[model samples]
Target chain A: MSVLDKIYEKAKANPQKVAFPEAENEKMMQAAYETGKEGYIKPILVGDSTRIKELIAERGYEESVFEIIDIAEESYKNDVVARYVALPHTMLKEKAIGRRMENPLYYAMAMQAVGDADVTFAGIDNTTGDVLLAGQMIIGLKEGISTVSSIGLCDIPGFEGSEGQLLAVGDSAVCTNPTPEQLADIAISACDTVKGLLDWEPRCAMVCYSTLGSGQGELIDKVKEALAIANEKRPDLDIDGEFQLDAAIVPAVAAKKVNRESKVAGKANVLIWPDLNVGNTAVKLIQQFGHADAYGPMLQGFNSIVCDCSRGAPVSEIKGNVVISAVRAMGQK
Target chain B: MERKELEAQIIKMVAQCYNADEAKLSVDSVFGEDISGTSVMMVGLVSEIENELDAMIQLSDAAACKTIGDLVDKVEEEL
Candidate 1:
């Protein structure tokens, strides 16, 4: 099965409440409809209730197939505001709370924070910053996680390093230039996500411009330090790095480059890039030139399961994200 | 580090973060209002400060700070 197919199977079996804050968008609404129809998730659409109902009717879909949360409704607004006020010393104070409640995305997140929803899938009509800020201020980060990072699940044909065709490339959509500690956190977050969604023992390669002690520079040092920190923090996982892309995924390169025998040397399924520029560029290059399919820019390190879809993503991509987000929510449960 | 030294470092960091002049960024300069710090910039600032002080600063505490001095005070408190 494809990774998404497996995730769809798992999600369909134990469906979770996944909220789509950009429910007003045509693509998002259609994806939500499909997600609910396939039993992959129970989609909660957060937008104008009447308009959403009209759209459902217009689209020939059952209104009961999706639950709509209208932020404009006085009662629902009051409930979200009340929930925001009740959180233990919430960061969203009076001024922030007023501003946040006006945005449906934050309201949707507030619902997740208060257990009214399970997960939030958004960013269709909003910037990544908006989605991330709402998530951080409302749902907050998981315990001991100080930073929020993202991972792109790449399915590259002819890429034989990983167990399947999938590889997790991280800090692609966040963390422009991560410090060593933050890089370590990104690795751990990616590992947790891979294990949860794909059910694989993540072998991470902290990719950089250098491989082992082959080169020396500030960038290489940063990757090396990150590797040490990740190793010290999680001894159970197989992770190594300061590896060049070739050394990371090709067994021949791994055998020639370093003396130490490493499980993740050539078999790394999770490639933690040194910076956002490198990660983002590499993934896009692969997608364009190599004809690989990249599934996510999945937000990680949050206490709750929240995923962001590119604003230009199609209905199929949105549906895939809902299933992936549902699978993550199931893992969390 | 002395409080003044730490304060200087923070002003420089915040100024760099906002792409403003260091001389204009006083200790009382609010991060979001006076200095224009975004959530992404805040994360970078927290990392920079932590590395400088060799101490952990809670993001919640940092987010609560209204000014550079408030951040310095939190760092002092942590120390």
Candidate 2:
């Protein structure tokens, strides 16, 4: 089965509560309704209750099918603010708490923080910065993870390297120019995510213009440092790199280009790009030119499950993201 | 660590983050305006400080620190 299908099966076995902070968006509402109706997740929509009811009525979905959290409700607002304040070492001061309490994204994260919700999928009408800030401020990062990065699940059909078609390309949406340390974190997080989502051991390639010592530049230096750092930190991970794209994936090319014997040199399924420019461009190229099915820019490294949707995502994609988030939530539980 | 020692470390780390010499930075140097640090760079700096000091420096708290001195104070507070 496909990743989404496997995720759906797992989600069905363990239904998690997912909050949609952008309930005002029609796409988000539709996806929440569909996913809720299909029993993939228990949808909690954060918005105005009356308006959400109207939208649900218009969409021919029963209002009883999904639970709606009205942000304006005094009790709910107080609950979210209380949760935010309770978070240890929260830098959201008293003055900012009121303003943040007014935001649904914060409310969604607050719900996750306090265990009112299992996961949150947002970013329909918000920028990545806003989503990430809310996540950082409220849900916080997993222990030992200082940076939050993103991973894109690209399923390039007929791709030779991966056992399945799906490959995890990371730091594509967040971390525009990650330092070596941040790049290592991104790779480690992506590997953990693959292990969680795909239930397979991840072989990661730190993708760059150089393969081993074949090329030289500051960029290659950064990749080499990231590879070393990741290897040192996560000795169990099968990761190697400073590889050109061909050397990282194609075994024949890796054999010819890389002098050292390596496990992940050519057969890498997780490609950690050196920078966002390369990672983002490669994912889009795969989506358009390579005709791949791409699903994410999924935010990783948070203590709780939080995924960011592309603002332009359609209803189906939103529903798929909800499933992905549910699957992540299940894994965490 | 003593105040002077901590301040010296903060300045050195900030200068390293900015890819400049420690001589170029001071306790009064503002992080973004004076030292050319981006938000991403600040995150890295926070992680570096946490690792170096073996403390939890909250990102929000780190972001609130405008200058090298402020960062030192934050680190000291965490310590």
Candidate 3:
């Protein structure tokens, strides 16, 4: 079965409560309807009630299936939201100040903060900054967390030699060019996420254009430093880098080229790029040109649960994203 | 700073980072051409601009920075 199938089964068994904040959007409302029908999650649709009803009728789905929180009317939304925040005065005041907190994205986050929902996903109509800030400010980054990054969970279907590979390419959506320390944190966080969400033992490769001392540059040095730090802290992990992409993934290629007897060599399922550009571009390339399936650009390192999807994503993509985000919310890794 | 001065600074930074001639930079300088900061360099430039200007410039902002003048206007607006 596919990864989504497994997750959907797991989620269905537990039937965790999840939220779709931008439920007012036509596509999101449609997705919520499907999610409800599937019985994997109890979805809270946060937006204007009338708009949601219109969308439900528009999609030809039953409106009684999902719960809706109407934020169109200030007094009503404020009354409901105010009860949740400890600083009710401040939240109430803010509700009165702005145009219903811009959209349900913020209000939805506030809901998650107060345990109204187990996981929240948005960004179809929001920017990364908007999603990140709402998450950081309202949800807040976790203690000991510095920045948020993304991981792509690619489920390649039965490539003759390799059956299942769950790889992570990161610092893609968040940090620009992380400091060496930040890179170490990213590696550790990604390793944990991979182990938790995908159940794959991490064979981490810190990738670059160069392979194992073949190249000389500052970028190479950064990758080397990060690998060293990550290994020192989590010595049990098979993490090594300053290697090229090909050597990292293919065991025979890595054995011949990298000259390292390390287990991670040629067996890397988690690839941590030197920077955001490499990580972001590499994943997109894999998805676009290589025909490899991709999931996420899911945010990591937040205190409470907050995740973002692409503004251009379809409902299935968002559904896949929710699986990853919900796994994160469960505090697995 | 006058908009032109900021423009000049942007041109200088792009020229240095992208290894292109300063003369190629203009208000409409698209990054990938006439000098380009690979993704790494773009992030670095964003940091530099933020540090120099004490503003919080985002990567999304960098996506629109095509030319020397384009970066200058962005920097000026943020400043």
DockQ of 2: 0.07
Give the lDDT of residue B45 in candidate 3.
61
Runs with alpha carbons beyond 4 Å of true place in candidate 3: A72-102, A157-166, A232-237, A257-261, A331-333, B1-79
The sequence of per-residue lDDT tens digits that candidate 1 reaches over residues A157-249 is 887766767788998888887878889989999999988888888999999888878899998999999889989988888888878988888
TM-score of each: 0.80, 0.81, 0.71
Model 3: per-residue Cα lDDT at residue A54: 86
Which run of 10 residues does model 3 chain B get worst, by summed lDDT?
B36-45
By summed lDDT, which 10 consecutive residues of candidate 2 chain A come out lowest? A89-98
lDDT of 1 by residue, B5-76 (tens): 989988987777567889888998877678863465675566556555655575778889999999999988
| DockQ for each numbered candidate | 0.06, 0.07, 0.04
Indicate the DockQ of the complex predicted as candidate 1. 0.06
lDDT of 2 at A204: 94
> How many backbone collisions does model 1 have?
0
Estimate the lDDT of model 3. Answer: 0.70
Error of 1 at A315 (Å): 0.9
Tell me what TM-score chain A of model 3 achieves.
0.83
Q: Is the docking of candidate 1 incorrect, acceptable, medium or high quality?
A: incorrect
Docking class of 2: incorrect
